[model samples]
Target: MCSISFLVLILFSTNFFLFSLLMLIKDFCMFIEWEVVSFNSCSIVMTFLFDWMSLLFMSFVLLISSLVIYYSKEYMGGDVNINRFIMLVLMFVLSMMLLIISPNLISILLGWDGLGLVSYCLVIYFQNVKSYNAGMLTALSNRIGDVAFLLAIAWMLNYGSWNYIFYLETMKNSIEMEIIGGLIMLAAMTKSAQIPFSSWLPAAMAAPTPVSALVHSSTLVTAGIYLLIRFNILLCDSWMGQVLLLLSGLTMFMAGLGANFEYDLKKIIALSTLSQLGLMMSILSMGFYKLAFFHLLSHALFKALLFMCAGAIIHNMNNSQDIRLMGGLGIYMPLTSGCFNVANLALCGMPFLAGFYSKDLILEIVSLSYINMFSFFLYFFSTGLTVCYSFRLVYYSMTGELNCGSLNMLSDEGWIMLRGMSGLLIMSIIGGSMLSWLIFPTPYMICLPIYLKLLTLFVCISGGLLGYLISNVSLFYFNKSLNNYLVSYFSGSMWFMPYISTYGVINPPLVLGSVVYKSFDQGWSEFMGGQNLYNKLVEYSQLVYFLHNNNLKIYLLLFVLWITFLFSFFFLF
Candidate 1:
């Protein structure tokens, strides 16, 4: 694992530099698609896109994955299945690459499906209940998107080509194109864990930390956003676009609130991821694909680093995941703590960092756009809540009193882990400004009121203050009405999404199945189908035998009795 990771790391670093130079020379260049299957009207082509966007995304995916595989060498040391882990991560990277470069729907589905399947395998690699459940959830949730993709391909059949890039301009107003846009939007939402489908992402924390760092927080979740980025021009002024804008705002707000209430160390990070994804989706809805792409890159860098740091902390804490039991680790593990704080601050969109360059610009864009009051409320509140939870997280795990049982088992120094994190940590710090320069080349012209310009700063400061005060209070004893059973339970369990998806969506069908089995299949079908007919036939046959009379004298008497019986039957009738 270590050797492979190191080799890939060096290879991608070189590739990245070369791509950077090439991008400077040419704005965009696409390879001629190799024809796979040519039909009467359409052909399945395997093509590669090598624009700056795909190149940059692929470079980052490779970089993070290499570090993750390298880090897994130490974190997963002594495990029997460590090799399998590394191989899965490698396959994941391959899938991400395929998704990034593919220009046709067929190849895109190949990549998308690969990611969903491989991630499920990774999630269940632990062979425990939690891993099993999480894997199922993740797989099933993504399956919805896979179906959506297949539907999209079927819909594209009307356009006579699976290469959607060609149709983006001509098909924008066609009614059939609306179906395509809506299906693609639906697919993107599921893959990105938006709204009702979002339960899978945080639950997917059951995967090992390296997997979470490489897959969930970065590549897999961003696949949807990337697809939408490529399809952005088609979505303008469409109903799907408007729906996406609304859903994204709600998703951001929901995930932010969920993060505030979450206690699991990994899950908090995961929920934060969901919120950021919402932000990206919302921005994309507003027709700022470049900004979404920018934030996507920056978030990948820091979120990957953040998860890796969390992995380090969890390793040192003897495999414990509860934040309530963790505190004052900064004193014992300053290096890992420093990385965590850096990532956290970056996540909160701290000044001049990677997130700030993209996030601040995104907020400014939203402010400048003509949007409804509801959307504006969701946008700003989610932004402020981001700061609140970031501070809350830092205080709970890094600054409060040490509650972990023993220091003898804690480990602070792991050179492999630190080395793995170093690459992304550096990227997390400078990726935004670097990409901002490379991507935009020219800055966005901003004309806003002074108050609007300072809103981000004000939101950050106020949220941070509230975060400190809230973290200091006793949450269970805060004595607020929202702490009641229904409200607290709803918020704590992510608005009962687990129940809605598992019990609500899945169990009802199972219950109906049982009913169908017993009532229609077992009872009525059994009696009415074969058995009742056979019993009636047997009874009538037995009675007919008595009337048939075998003896000759008995035959005479039987004939006479039959005549009398016929007379009596007629009279009775």
Candidate 2:
């Protein structure tokens, strides 16, 4: 495990070195005497690594890759194609690094598309048809982002701001700027699986557990949130920014609600991911960039930890992932259950854990946004929904009566998996200290009303207690219809606009092609016209066939003579 992590560190170090070199060349090219040569050289460097944004993204790419590599060595034991899995995972990380660090619009485009491609491959690493279909669905669904990013690249290139620095400096007030912003937001929406793009994420659980942790929790989907944060200056001033906040708030509410009903352990976390992203997006929408980033940092720790724990549970339980099959795990897998319980509590904003500080800030930011009452209600409701579902996650998996599967009656996981969870647990406990200065920078601490902090704690605890009540075994059967209504209809079908926009982009051509193909199978005459023509040709050519067969040698000579005559005729003509 240590060796694997060392290799990942080396991989990131080399990639970062390459990016730094490209950046230096780009800077140098700006002042060289040979104008055309300098310009072309700069363009190449720009296409590689030319911006502060990419540099910022590199930190996340490296951090998450290091953690995941350490994780895989233990999680994927005895799995075939271990080398292939590592290569693909590395490729995914590299693609994200490129996407984040590319200096030119075209390079950014490649990185963007490359991340999508690599993620699709990783999603299907299991070689199961279900995983493959999930990968295909994920790829197809996100193609909407490709269109948007491609358009943004084309627009920027045409505007003479194709380079990263040029784009940041010059494209501010141009009409193309707004177009680019809109395109970028569209891409972010799809990449993050916001609203209508949400289903693909739950489906993506077909991947291996480690992939889910990396993809949903730590890295790939977060890239969109990172994009929004990096461009907050540009987006915050526009209506698009406000729209993102509203959409993000709604996504949080629905995702939280969805998690309430998810029985699958991984899917529950997947929904939590959507909810957490929604919260980050909502905070970002309000121009609280630092606070949003703080939440993002804290979220990465707790969510990744939670997902890793889920992976362990699934692994030990003969690959069973449904929480319904899980209960009393705290008795069996004490270390894992303890780590997960702590993470879950922090995830739902328990006090002192990293999640509390970050989540409360999001609520505060939401309260400050000048949204309508409906939006306000949604935000508040989402807060309650968050507590309820998060508590359910803990109760269903850890605290309930023991109902271990025959395969996982009692077992222990490898040290590598436990190490990842332990690392996250430590981060969760002490990570909030990094932001302590943000809350209390001076020697003298500025204190909020005790009641208010207590109120915040009260709300969180009450929400958790309510969730426990709602998910208690005795009450579960009674909540079935309510659960279906909330998860299936409200969570899944609620994103009418985002859904149409996300799916509509890919559906039209594919649906048209499907219709065209299906028509051929509908028994229409035109569909069978080619077959009829072939049959008629065969019938009419029977005399020719018989004449040829009657004298095979003569026919061969005649055919050769005809071919020679045809070539001679063409040449003469």
Best by TM-score: 1
lDDT of all predictions, in order shown? 0.87, 0.73
Tens digits of per-residue lDDT, candidate 2, 11-111, equal 77557546545654464322121223356337233345434235434654566566767777888877777778878877777777766655556766776
Q: What's model 1's overall lDDT?
A: 0.87
Cα RMSD, each candidate: 5.2, 7.6
Off by over 4 Å in 1: 36-44, 475-485, 518-573
lDDT of 2: 0.73
Least well predicted 10-residue stretch by lDDT in candidate 2: 28-37
By summed lDDT, the worst window of 10 consecutive residues in model 1 runs over 474-483
- Relative to the true structure, candidate 2 reaches a TM of 0.79
The residue-by-residue lDDT of candidate 1 on 80-158, one tens digit each, is: 9888778888888889889988888988998999999999998998889989999999999999989989999999898
- Clash pairs for candidate 1: none
